[model samples]
Target: ILIDGALQNLDFSSGSVEFHNLVIERELNQKVMGGTEDEIYIFYMRFRRGIRVGIRLSKKILLIQLEIDSGFRNGTLGLLGTFNDNQNDEFVLPNGTVFISGASQTDQNLHLYGLHWRTQEISSLFKYDGTQSWSSINNLTFVPLFFNPNLTAFIPNATIRRYAQDICYGEGLNDPTPEQRKPCYFDFSVTFDADIANDTEKTLKTIDTAKKTL
Candidate 1:
């Protein structure tokens, strides 16, 4: 990852290190600026003015949460959407197409919103193995999500909603709220993997506790 201007190799390292402006602050007490917890790596950055970013990375997920000052309100665009304190115009496309508010987020509309914002991965910040290229995987008429309505047209006998709900809400985890468990439902429904949702749940909990420190 690019911290300030230098590149960092955080793939295997876990200890505290300070090299120039790059600082890896381990999770200790409540003053953690950023560090690693288990296999998850947390990185926090506070730029000039009032722009803050918290990044949590694991093998299965990458969460980048942005915290900006109110001065830049309505001054940004793209996948973050129009931040004018109005939820109605959240999904504005590059060509000025908007999935207007009050329209239920169906599988089609959600795919439209997601696919519109994907850019060509010309370059990457980190090194990895056996990664698929955008062109190799991104087909013109392909969608990664299957639990929603679009999949039913092809598979008439598909039944995933009840199992997904049971794993997400009925697994006896009393800590995460309904909002927090929403990711688990979607993840389980998409991949049909019960263990993959742990990444989302852990990332959310860590963000909740470390938000104040960031």
Candidate 2:
């Protein structure tokens, strides 16, 4: 929930594209552990050049896995492309419980995504390329512009696998556990096309009239 404007206040301006299409959606709610499990998240997109993604899952869920991690700093965890709604497997090992820190102090280099779905609505459409810099912490002069949508989930119950051991036994342990509990609630919305290849059919009828005005 740190989305720092990739066009946060979109307006097709009477139709005449220039934003370059992108519509990522999310509404994933996991109910503790439920049989098959595999989930990881890190979506920080504010345009870094790489677009063309169309993934919609919510017919009661079934998108087994999708991995796309590019330009991530701290030991370059590279592994790109792996989308499936049914077949094509192989790409599920965040076993370290997948942890990613804030772009390692700017120069923004992170797009780590590994999602295995059983569904509660998770949509996608990609195409990004913001001067591709694959950031590698090279004496950061000043790179302070960020976008965010970080999510992480790996199921097997035990209160959702003790979220990193309840943040290391509740840090300074004020000693008073058992009260925090949340199970499901998520909502999403993202529709864009400031420049749809110079007006592709009136930018899909102005993105279907701005998604029926939401």
> How much lDDT does each candidate structure score?
0.58, 0.30
Model 2, span 1-214: residue lDDT tens: 2133143443334432233454343333442222333342222222334433323333233233343334332322214323433122223334533333334422132322322221122232332246432243222344332322222322224443343223322433421322121111011111121122112333345676899999
Clashes of 2: 21
lDDT of 1 by residue, 37-135 (tens): 444446666555667677775445566888888988987666777879888788887787676457566556777787777765674343333554456
Model 1 TM: 0.56
As a TM-score, model 2 comes out at: 0.17
What lDDT score goes with residue 13 in model 2?
41
Among these predictions, the greatest TM-score belongs to 1
